[model samples]
Target chain A: MLMILDYIKEKAEFINQALAETMDQLEGVPPVLKESMKYSLLAGGKRIRPVLVLATVEALNGDEEKALPFACAIEMIHTYSLIHDDLPSMDNDDYRRGQLTNHKKFGESTAILAGDALLTEAFGLMAAGAKNAHLPLDVALTIIEEGARCAGSRGMIAGQIYDLQSENKKISLAQLEQIHRLKTGDLIAFSVRTGAHIAGASQRTLQALTEFAYGLGLAFQIQDDILDVIGDQEKLGKPVGSDQEKNKATYPALLGLDEAKRKLSVCIEEAKGKIREHDEIRPARLLEIADYLLSRDW
Target chain B: MLMILDYIKEKAEFINQALAETMDQLEGVPPVLKESMKYSLLAGGKRIRPVLVLATVEALNGDEEKALPFACAIEMIHTYSLIHDDLPSMDNDDYRRGQLTNHKKFGESTAILAGDALLTEAFGLMAAGAKNAHLPLDVALTIIEEGARCAGSRGMIAGQIYDLQSENKKISLAQLEQIHRLKTGDLIAFSVRTGAHIAGASQRTLQALTEFAYGLGLAFQIQDDILDVIGDQEKLGKPVGSDQEKNKATYPALLGLDEAKRKLSVCIEEAKGKIREHDEIRPARLLEIADYLLSRDW
Candidate 1:
């Protein structure tokens, strides 16, 4: 456990350094725009999505160097989504991850541009990664296209649209699942599969990783719902009951709390089963990441 | 004259068809979301950016089919920016291209998502273009990165930030130029340069196109400002004097109308000079495009 923790820490430091370098290239950008972008980007988080990218690459014995930019790019997309979601016009949150939200710290205008910059830059980073790696044009372009699709209308944006429409409305469990699966699930699945794509994993192994990550993403969202109800505010760094206050649908809100927990546990185990069935290769890092996901309170 | 007009009409039709085909793929995207996206994307406009891309490719005798997706992608980016700019929190414009603006047509939340989806899908279309063209990976990646940079923090978004900040303020011509260069110029410049990039134009030719497009873009903005004051709203579609209403520092506002017109004439001449000096290629289409820019009232 300690070794895996250390591994995550080491990979996280690499992502942090890469992200800083990425943010430093904002020549001629307004100081406020740059500052707002850096604030949210540098705000501390678990770096789960980037870590998943690196871990998947490692699990397939791919070079971390080749995957590092991609890992950072994934994190950028995640950060931008959070910034935009926290806007007054969106989720209307004042704080995120224990710091003032982008729109709160900077004015709403700057924060909005900051998010736009981050999202746009993520693509540049992705293309640069593929270019720097000397990947084939088709392969590099396919990877980029995949990232776009996973993050765009059919995936994350779709999820956000559904989530917004569902606000203050009573939605069925099946509908809730649909929202999470597209909104949160697609990007997580993309992170894992992108690493596998980088590593040139076989179809069988790629299929396994996709299945595992899909289950893991749903479980992660379920646990988040559960945490909102029972987790400590100090540890979580945000107010509890935001979902309830918004009357937003959540796994725990629709299902009973115990049932939600049970469902999360079952899903995690199922994800682990997918990993274990991958020709008994023993993907230690990925399984450990899943374990950590289930255990984290924040 | 007739040939150039015919060529422009032909390319514009191709772009329209391609855009329609692209929008038809939003199967699972929610109805309102899909409708909102289609509403802005399919809204009739001059299609100037896409036309430039197509024209540049034609000048270089490159494959228009290969550049079709990229041309559509530029238009998508243009449309998305308009949608976001017209949002209640942003420009608060209720109409664009003579139609109700996206937020006004569908609602703020869906408009935001629609803009995001349009932007994301544009990148996807670019990648798909590269893939379909079988362009070398490095070249394609470089082009993609360039587009991202031009449209991202250091370019279009930066311009937007500055524009928002400069609202209701007296600003110098230099400052106004910077805002327009970053906001409107970079992407227009990008539209020209990207086509050259696709055609693998010589570095010298690319440099000429960049310089030409830079001047042309500024001239285009000045014409827009002039039209805002003197042109009929019936022809321009949207209301006139929006810049004055917003206290925007336009070339005319900063330079006086006569001087702004002089600046526009000098710019058009300088842009034409760049085209003429382009290794004697006789880029007739580009010259006509510049001429059209100088004459267009809308």
Candidate 2:
């Protein structure tokens, strides 16, 4: 467990340094906007998505350098979505990770532009990655298209709109699943699958990785909902009960707490099952992540 | 002139049909979201940017089919920016093209998501174009990077942020020009240059095309300001003098109406010169469009 944790920590550090360097290289973004983007991007997090990308590459014995741009690109996309979701016009989140959110710290207009810039920069990085990594044109094109599709209207944006419109309304579990699948699952799956792509993994390997990502992504969200209801504020670094306060639906809200926990366990189990299928060839990192995610006893 | 006009009309018709078909083919986008996206994208405009894309391709004798995706993508980007700019958090305009703005038609959240979708979809289209056209990896990568850079923070979004920050405030002529160049000029120039790129034009041709686009983009904005001051509202299709009402800076405000007009002519002349430099091999459409844009007598 500790070894896997160390691996993630190292990967996270690499991602952070790369992200900072990328921001420094932005030639034309205004300084203020750049600052806002960098601030949010550099804010400490688990860096799980990026780790998944690199670990998947490791599983396939692919060039880690070739996947670095993709790892960083995923983080940029994640940060941009966080910034936009925190806007007053969107989720109205005032604080994130115990610090003032992007809009709170940098004003609304700059925050908006910062998010826009990050989103743009991510795609630029993805395309640039194709050239920098010497990946085949079709593969690079596929990655770009998948990344955009997962994050765009029919994907994350759609989830957000559905989430917003479902406010104060009774949303069914199926509808909630649809929203989460779009909002969180799609991007997480893209991250896992994209790494597999960069590594030139087989279709079978990619499918298994995607299945693992889907299960893990939902379980992660479910854990989030559970934590929100019963979490140490000092450890969590953010307030709890905000979802209920906002009249937003969540796993625990729609299903009973016990049922939600049961679902989380099921998802984790399924994810592990998928990872175990590739046990001979897959790296231990993916399995470690899946197992560690559900174990509450730290 | 008549020939070029016919060319533009034909191109616009093609773009319109392609855009309509594309919207209909979106797989997972919700019906309401699709409606919102189509409503804004299909709304009639001059199709100037898309036309420039194809015209430049034509000028270079490139495959029109290869250029179609890019042309559609640029228009999508243009539409997305307009939708976001009209949001209540930004410019707060109620009408666009003599119709209710996206937000006014759909709810605010839907409109915002629609814009996001369009923006994301546009990137997807660019990548897809690379595969469809079988362009070389390097060229495809370059197009994607340039598109993202021009539309992202350093370009259009930067202009938007500066414009918002400068609201109701005194700004210098150079500052206003900076804003316009970033917001309007960059994407316009990108549109023209990208088409030249698709044609595999020489560096000299690309540079000349870029110079023409830069000059023409700025001049187009200047003419817009002039129209706001004195042009007929019915022909313009939306409320005039809104920039002045918003206390936003404009060419007429900074350069004075007379000086602005003189500068507009200088820009037009400069743009024509760039086009004429390639007269031996370049298509006449580029020069004709440059001349036709500012000429009131259709």
Across B1-298, the per-residue lDDT of candidate 1 in tens digits comes to 5576687787788899999999897567887888998898888788889999988987888877888889999899989889888877678898888899998888777887788888889999999988989876766888889889899988998889888888888888888899889988999999988888888888889889999889989999899999988888978889999888888888878888899889999999998899885663458999998988888888
lDDT of 2 by residue, B1-298 (tens): 4587787788999999999987877788877898999999999887899999988988888888999999999999999999988988789999887789998999776787788789889999999888989998888899999998899977999899888989999999999889989999999999988898888988888888898998989888899888888877777777888989998899998889999999999998998788785843375888788877877521
Docking quality tier of candidate 2? Answer: medium
Which candidate comes out best when scored by DockQ?
1
RMSD after CA superposition, every candidate: 1.4, 1.8
Per-residue CA lDDT of model 2 for A1-298, tens digit only, reads: 4587677788899999998898888887777888899889998877878888998888888888899998899999888888888887678898887789998999876786687788888999998888988999979999999998899877888888788878899989999888888888998999998999999988888888898898988888888888888777666667888888998899999998999999999989888788686843465778888877786421
Name the best candidate (by TM-score).
1
- lDDT score for residue B239 of model 1: 96
Instruction: For candidate 1, give the lDDT of residue A162.
Output: 89
lDDT of 2: 0.86
Show the lowest summed lDDT stretch of 10 residues, model 2 chain A: A289-298
Q: Give the lDDT of residue B17 in candidate 2.
A: 95
What DockQ number belongs to candidate 2? 0.76
B123: Cα error in model 2, Å: 0.6
How much is A133 displaced in model 1, in angstroms? 1.3
